[model samples]
Target: MAKHARPGRIDPTWPDLPDGEHPVSELAAATQGSLSPFGDVEFPLDDVPYVHPVTEINR
Candidate 1:
């Protein structure tokens, strides 16, 4: 028998819809040129502590 799917649940066989209607797709499009966790987009480079070159490290 086929299993029923519902909101807040995951289904392995979900079909891909057009970008306009897909939740993740729409989010990606919205942040296409900006920094977003869901994307590999980079932020405007200026000065960020964590990203700075490692100057000192203990052995």
Candidate 2:
């Protein structure tokens, strides 16, 4: 029988991601360029110190 997947847990099948520290503004600027500027999406850049990755998901 197959085991049930648990909530708030990553599946074993998924690739492992390396953890590292980085400034939020740098990350935001890097990703924002992926979107079309003409579209209705915006990610304004701000110079801030390091932000935790887990907490950034909620933003």
Best by TM-score: 1
Residue-level lDDT of model 2, residues 1-59, one tens digit each, is 99897776966666555677443434655554455644654446365556766744665
lDDT by residue (tens digit), candidate 1, 1-59: 97786756867578778876764454556444444663554568576657556777778
CA deviation > 4 Å runs, candidate 1:
1-20, 26-35, 38-44, 51-59
After superposition, which runs of candidate 2 have C-alpha atoms over 4 Å from their true positions? Answer: 1-14, 21-34, 37-59
Question: Which consecutive 10 residues in model 2 have the weakest lDDT in total?
Answer: 21-30
List TM-score per model, in order.
0.24, 0.17
Per-residue error for 3 in candidate 1, Å, reads 16
In candidate 1 the C-alpha lDDT for residue 4 amounts to: 81
Model 1 Cα shift for residue 54 (angstroms): 9.2
TM-score of 1: 0.24
Task: Name the lDDT value of residue 3 in candidate 1.
Answer: 72
